[model samples]
Target: MTHAATANLPFKVHDIRVEGLQRLPVEKVYAALPIQAGDSIDHDQVADAVKRLFATGNFEDVQLGRDGDDLVVIVSERPTIAKIDISGNKSIDEDNLRKGLKQAGLVEGEVYQRSTLQAIAGELQRQYVSQGRYGADIQTKSVALPRNRVELKIEIYEGKAARIRDINIVGNTLFDDDTLLKDFELKPSHFWSFIKGDDKYSREKLSGDLERLRSYYLDRGYINFSIESTQVSVTPDRKNVFITINVAEGEQYTVNDVKLAGDLVVDENQLRPLLVIKKGQVFSQQLVTYTSDLIKRRLGNEGYTFAEVHGVEQDTGSDNNTVDVTFYVDPGNKVYVRRINFTGNAKTDDEVLRRELRQFEQAPANTSLIDLSRQRLQRLGYFSTVDADTPRVPNSDDLVDVDYKVEEQPSGSIGANVGYSDSSGFIFGANVTQNNWRGTGNRVSFALSRSDVRDSYSFSHYNPYYTLDGVSRGFSLFYSKIDFDQTSVASYAADRLGGSVTFGYPISEYSRLSFGATYEKTDITTGDYVAYDIYQFLDEYGDKFNEYKGNISLQTSTLNRGVLPDRGWSSTLGLEVAVPGSDYGFYKLNWSGQKYFPLTRRWTVRTRGEVGYGDGYGQDKSLPFFENYYSGGIGSVRGYESRSLGPRSPGMIYVDNGTVDPSPDPVGGNLLTEASLELIFPTPFAPDSRSVRTFLFADAGNVFQTEFNDAADNVSWNEMRTSVGVGLTWLTAIGPLSFDLAKPLNDQPGDDTEVFQFSLGQVF
Candidate 1:
């Protein structure tokens, strides 16, 4: 072709026009144009604008030309996403994949970016590979449709999971293979031994197990223990993987001597007692840590806010089996609290939080004070989280400001429940309560319940901190109607309306004493042939049937160590006394105590016991049925139903005949005592989450009349109602769920004990 010789002539653009603009406004095109009406166009600017337009991923092609002093911009828009299809994902369902892609900003009707599509494909492949599908293939295809949209299809071919062929452990002579294997969840099955069963493997879980093993050895004084190497290999066929762990088990050492070093604020003699380690003893990291904690705690109590104790070991040249330990104390600058701050209390008042703080501003910042402040806040139950940190002042190591952040949670709830029991069938109840009423550390509740045997409604309020120094006060009003088939006394039905006010005084942080009085009016309907003695007493005391009762109780609780409790103990003792001369005149006392001790790192032993007694006076010589103690079930004996283990009535009374004593002899109404021992084990599944606990328990208890002569005697093996069972306790969102499968060691005639019992909420 011959070229025209017009290179020197002026190049002119005819016009500038825009096409294929739907969502793109006409004004946008004009704004992007480089050449205005009557202006010469530059080829570089036109090329740049065209590149910018195509970079938006909104157009497939762009053409720029000139028509007489105007630039012509023509574009072909890329197709929008119309449909998405996914297939061949069994391990990961299609819906989940779609959701994942959607979260990554992919959806129909949006402009499709090639980079984003490629990223999605890569992510999908990675997920499949993680699931052990090494040979899996993923391909994505797009089809253009009408209306400038496209459809996408993702096809996957996922093969079987990669199996584990062998797991080999080297350089361990202390424990056998079985013991080490138990720590690992991976195992080889008979059919797939070559591939190690193709089990689903979790790298995180394996890492955790290795850490556990390390800690297990370190805690036993193997301080130099180390993992040499870890290797995982896959077979040529990609069907199985082999794991190998090489470890270096250093020599076990014993403590030769323990000495203190550095600037010690406390006397050496005083500090030596706190060190739990002893000479010639098996060196234990736990003991060393315990001693460090003890020193820290003592220093904290003395207002040494910034104190640290580090246990250092000096190796002796004796076969590498012995070491002398020294505790080096670094007493940093004594920190003083410049300020205390609280945050995240939108609903609660600032004063409510300030009053609970044990550590005050302008005071020495001590660890114990901060811990006590945190506990005080926790006891209010207002906040779900309370964290304290000492943010040091800039350029001043001695000055620090404490920040106490609290996260307030919902303190009110409306709950309804329906329950059934052999004694009280079809029980239904509901309640509305606010534990932190108006953020004042008070409780208010309204409850209504109805059952086949009883019906009641009650309103109550309590101020946990009624006084500035920590006294509590409470008041309750209730109306109840009870129908009883009293075989021991008489067949009668009574309705009562009552109210009571109580005041509780905290003798100390661990103990409290409470006094309360109630006024109740009871209307008893008797048969024509009622018992002569009861009829005479009631008739003589007519209109004076209104009864008044008063009670005084003392309760105490203590925990030597509150967190990570292993050696210390917690106990509670309660004694309640009812005054004489009241309508139901009797003196009742209830006492309970619990203790926990750790025998080893993995073993914990706990013991608990409870006793209840009542003595009658005046017209009534015994406790009322409502006031009697009933034992059995998870909280009590764990082998029987509530209130069903004592003297029970045989049948209902006949009004016309005034027939009493339903059974040949009643066996359900009596004072009770119980004792139990438990061994608790921490679960390995979720160590940090204290949601579940496993326990093996042995329980023994019995119920008897107040006048029973042998009440204080030690229960013999034959006399004791013993039960052995394993319990699973789950700290659920609602409350703790205790499920136990118990078998009674000794069974009496006509006993209908259940083989399994599942209960919700704490027994205490």
Candidate 2:
């Protein structure tokens, strides 16, 4: 910018000339200038134009000049960013760092600013410090390239996270230091801290810990407790952190009285019983909050979705040890639902989710009904998250709309694997399963497996909402070959080819009635040294038979959860009868049930029982040997070998010199009974894990042969086998894996006792 160019600034301009512009259009320069062509300008206007051009951050410098009424603008454009590269980043992912940079207006193709780069560097450092990485280092550089572009590079050195060396709580009188520390997630470094990682310090985690500390006192009737100050100091090397929390422990208070105020929709007496806090009980913030929630829930059930219940407390006298609590209820207008909408379900059809909803579109917005709808979708296993919100319509106060958002997850699997099981021997299999086939909420599966004891090929399909009225339909086709000789049972083999079609109708909200019709062909093959029971059945009936069967079952469940239930009961009763056209007419009845009682937030007690009986009917006089129920396995008695318990058939004793070997084949019985009691607890390290659980269980069960054995003999109470065990079940990517360690308490002479049992793809 020369002095002569600014001399004649008030002259009229004919045209504008832009100089020294690169990667920027001449029109943009004209648009940025305050003075344009054919316009007269003054010195101040000229200076203002120069200032405006520089404000765009695109120009390094701007010079204003005039030549015979034509204003000339000379500009030096800033370098455009061409690329951004990052390296040495670990704790914070590279993609996220680049995203943050872009959000801060530092993306490629934009003009680069030196000031912005320094600000971004400071921001990056602050982020690392919040994560306890006080020693993290960050460096940025710009490399000039052809075409007036610059490439930005960011280097990061993520350091070790600071660990807490000590945590001290000062001025604590009501509670000891150890008790207060137990409520904090951050702990001092110890031998096991490396694995638990609780010693690692983070700003967000520390803040949350302080909140928990406050809640601990507030929930225990310390109404006046206050946290005076909290100090956190880092070591000189920034490798360790020390935290000290100071507090004032106030006197505990007791509840003076409880009263209900304001407009109560129902009778005050009706809501009084819903309160958990009594007049004589100690003041508990947690109880007050819980009671308020309960009141809201109770009102919600009555269609008072917008009701508000707030607890107001008043202290009396100088002692200040008694607080009067009053719950004020404001029952607003009862709101009704206007419409239901679904979002974020691109892969699933709308009708599939609509059928699961219990709340109607135009009905009142029942909170419980909406919650049940979400639970139903979660139980389908097709989504990872299901959320529902009822927002009021823009201009309507009495009508609200229900909106459901779902995040879909993988609901199908296709794979092949090779494994081994003690009961089935070496196994190889391939399977294709889809629980939500094509997002229609249909389940379809096909599998083929080969093992030493069993070989099977099966296909099944089920539709849970066949008619949208809570009816279900399913069909299955299977062919299986079982070798009993490998199972420590009778030396016999059976090949069964069968197919069945089932239909189910919902009897109630928690119960269903189902019926199935099946057709099968069974070919039983006997080998040498077969059990006497099997030989007798083969002698009476042919080795091959064709049968037609019908089954009816009723099942009901009220468990709070589908995977790991905390409280509820479930039961099933099934009856299978061979129709009149079967070669061997028979009938089987089975009853099973389970009940869970939550003893505490982290502990539960469960009881389970099952009973089964089978007998021949019509022309047949007794149950077929192969159809008998055998007890003792992972599903029955834990401390016994698979299907290796029950009545035993005679076998020859070999005598070689002075040694005698006894071989007894386990012959399954027609009647079976089993019961179990378990104390379930959350895993120690993962107390909130829904996929893992541990339990101590006691099991008692046995198989009885009634026809050949007298009722007073084999059916006695002493004949039942018993075991006590500790078990664990973990749900994994492949399937659920279960392990049990048991000790047989009442083992008979010939019973096979196995102290350790494990199985895959099974749960208890």
Candidate 3:
């Protein structure tokens, strides 16, 4: 509606009117228009009004006309989407389809645009094509509805993924095609191709395979190896794919000499020892990179936080097939910390974190100390992420600020559960724990539970930094009452009350030594079907007794995380002995260790072991049956029942006509040994979630008695029971929940086995 297209008349409009509007408010059209009834206007204003109306995306066409010096605006409204329907889609879920439609401006109740829908359909088809489904097709149509509304219908037919038929490797002599393809994920068609479908063609998988090919050559001294080309062709039917690769492998090269270049800042003699490769060794790209990293790290340790190192290989003429390697080091200016800052600790006190810092303000910036400080914060079991930054101060080449940012995890957890199980009979419990109370780095916990056969209550408190040197002090009290009238173990009940106090000394950053003293009093009550072993112990040591004990232990850990740690190892060895004048005189030695190895980005391998042996000193060289160790169930062997995998107790029997009566019950032994290996993997479909994990494990363990009447030998590996299972752990807001499904591999005739077990607890 410009002067060239319409009558060139510049005059003031007397009024404004809208035309061809339906199912739309007049105010909307007027709001989009830039031209209004004004004192003066021109053809340029009319053109701007039409452009603004079209820019609203609510109209199919917009035009301006004049009638009696009044402006007349006309528009054709686009059809509004009434509904959406989809069919023949399996690979893509309904939620993703709706999300895609919404992103592409084709959502229901929005104005329909044919071009946008058509373009989205093509983009979706390309996604399938990338997955080797070249025959996939997408069809879209809009059905007319009443009042100018339309229903969008999208149909997707996702064809089968093309299978790999064959693979060819050209220009490779030292390594055969079969040898190179052995490590590839994509393989030729085999007998199980139709069933497994793992041999299906994938562009990403082929790319990885090609990188592996390049690495295979580069690692074996082929310095000039290069891939000429790679071609993947699909059949006309799009049901099969063929791949071919051409490569050039240069002559193998060996290192003749190694030297250092550039400004190392540190002494050359000290940096020379860090070199991993020397003369007469084959050239290796991986070792070269590793050596470069080591050099950079050493430079960082010497106050140069922004050091750089690179390894360059030079040809040693054309005769001997040798290359001289040199590392170029650039140690940037030594920086000093101007200030130290901490953030993201809204709940934790700054003093609690500052005490763990190895780096100080107004000191030379040491990168190693900064990283160590971050690790110290992480190991506190309070924060999920600890990040450190040493950025240069404004316009200062030798000054920087050490800044630490931490995201605190949930240091407090509440757990409560109500359920009924036949074995436990109406089980219910609640637990409250706080590892960092009021941001003082103190721990407090309380627990209470009741069941048909058992009742327990406990309370505890600990201060991790009682003094400035990180010494710890803690104490706990517990009371329990049990009646085992309807359980798998010996039929006996006991009422026990105990309390303990402990002091910890930090031996190093990763280890601690602890000493504790305990006092316990126990009262026993026997049932009609009580085992003879319980009765014998009661008769020898009296029905009730007060015990005094002392324990000393040393523990060490380098775990990367407090909960579900993904790396590092931990170990603890302890000795507990009964004090003089106590009713019991036994001493126990226990040791346990766990190590985690990261296998991949999402997979880890964990190994663990535990062992315990107890025996009395003085005249009484026999261990009390109450101090015995029992294995199996949730925290032990998994498949077997709780405390149900040990020597059987000889029950009291009444002989009739000189025939011995049968009496059998499980009685824990004084010696315990166990070992476990697990493959920790990310939870399926929720791999990005940090609060959940899954693992598969194999466990083997058993309890044995060294000086018991029914003892067969000191120890026997053949008697050990083994189980394999899959488990899942979820850190919910309330607490941590774990579930295990296991199968026993060597269950005996009388062994009790449980296929499933679970525990939900709050760790403090």
Candidate 4:
């Protein structure tokens, strides 16, 4: 009945009756009704009640009637969602689809609205389009269940992404089309398009490409260059896209004058060196912006944390295509850090994180110091990510609080493995390591390993902040049973037990000095074919000996990263000497260094050098043969067998048979030298991966006997072996895997050469 016809009718309800209610509770229906039983209701009131019930969205139909002065309410409840299933989804994960459905109010147990299904389909199509899948199709279907519920099945057809067929650039006179197109990430399909995937048409990538195109011209003095228009079209089958970029190549401009204006909190002479822009140079947007950042940072280093720098250009009235540029600097009030807070470090103690901060509370808020603090925390390997923020306190312009947010990562490893390596032969090992043991900023490690040539067990512990002044203290206990007879280089075996107490003091931000005292006892044994030098040493020094050694080392590093450094250098100097009263008195000197220079945005050049010399002193006659150095393997020269690059041992003779058998094992030497140069490259397959490094390297090194044997000559430069190789290292979930293919350039007749070498679970 019409509301107008029922407006004049007034009725007093005796009771309320509900019908056609399937899932909705009767109490909920009563709550929605404006006129209940025992309340005098008019037709206007009944109309309002019906309208309110429909607004709840819980019913598809609501009907109101009166019989014998009793109000009757009938409702057809909306179906509850039973389940949601997604199919044919490839690029987008199923979980993401379910999350989108939930966000769209289509989750299970919620009321099902038919309009929502259509909206979800549209949204799904939009997502596919964003990924260049213009041919994607989505369809949704609902199946009714027994309990007034429905199940939604979303079917998705993710077609192939549209490939870029061609890109046309118009109105380009200053630079060639090839040069301009090189700036764009999107490209026309070429022979390598399938592998690179840059031929795919994506809006996000297109936007970035356009920005690069603008930056390319802007950096070159084309101050007025502008992109007139950009047009993108799709093929009929939706399999290909064509892009067209139109531009205006404006007149090149030159700088007439460069000046500094506004607040000069620092000496102008000091700030002038920071400006990259100069008079008579081409107008460079990049240089201007870089100069601005430099000025801001210079002020920031001086405690002006809120400094603002801007560059303004003024066109000259003369028609010489010249402009005058001015840099405006505003050095706000000097900011002080009132408090330093650590957050999101649930497992780690606050003190552990606080100790890493270079910027302290109640000190000047230095930007570089704060940045260095974050970098130090990240280098600790305890957290996956670290972020720092300095926000001013309310009503205090000069007082700011620094906050450090850290995301804890797994810092402990308990691993056991049975494997084989080219250098180690068959191996089995188990190790437990905790870099942040119990969140106390201490390191503890225990390991036991057995190989065909070596067996060892060791335990070590280190505290980085032993005394809170950045001093490190550690100790190690180790015992090794070495069977050199099973190895390719040695014809002897030894059982050794050793312990060391080590201390490290940080001399500066990038330098450390370390001192270590070690006590070791070695019991030597000769095999059936022992080298003559080994037999002679055993005869002179006996089969067992005790030695006490002390070492002092100094190291400095400015590397940007630990795993894969793009730029920086590190140098180390070490001296090791046996105690005066030891069985043998000797001193060893070593110097090593490595440097990395960034060649481009994605490539680097690295060089490494090492030199070592050792000799007897005081009462000793000769340096111990067991302490000699051998150079080879992946750690040294890649194309060579481990420890096989030294002087040969004199042949051994047996008296039992009137014939002598020669031992072909290598005799390690007291002098060692090595150098390497590498050109590091990026991996194409994993462009965004930081743990994978590929490089091409040339290496030269050798071990030379100085006084081990009378027949062996002194070290010679011509005796240095050389190799060239290409290598790749990948850090997988299990461990780092390294692979190398090398070719020896200058190989001696007795030298052992290997073209291919690989190792697992090892750092190179």
Model 4 lDDT tens row, 482-573:
77557654357778899999899999999999999999988886655567767767777788878899999999988765445667888999
Question: TM-score: which candidate is best?
Answer: 4
Give the per-residue lDDT of model 2 (tens digit) for 708-750.
4222125776889999989988766655678999999989787
lDDT of 3: 0.85
TM-score for candidate 2: 0.80
Flag regions of model 3 displaced more than 4 Å: 1-163, 182-208, 335-367, 373-429, 433-441, 449-455, 481-492, 527-530, 597-604, 653-662, 681-693, 708-718, 745-749, 762-764
lDDT (Cα, tens digit) per residue for candidate 1, span 1-764: 11112222235555567877766667766665555665544555566677677666677777765554555677776677899888888888888998987876668878776677788989888876666667778898888888877788888888776766677789989976567767666665446645444355445556776887787677677878899998877788877777788999898889989999998988888898998999988788878888999998778666677789999877887885899999999877777889888888888878778877878888888888888887767555566567888888889887888888887755555668899876666899997777667777678889899887779999999986788877889999989876554222344445778898999998876678888888777777653334333343355544234657777777665443222232344444444445554566666777777777777776778788987777566766555544557767887787765545654444444545646543432333336678999887876675443346677888888776644222222333354577888887665444446788888888577555776898754432
lDDT of 2 at 44: 79
Candidate 3 similarity to native, TM-score: 0.75
Model 2's number of clashes is 1
User: Please, what is the TM-score per model?
Assistant: 0.66, 0.80, 0.75, 0.82
Residue pairs in clash, model 3: none
lDDT of each: 0.70, 0.84, 0.85, 0.85
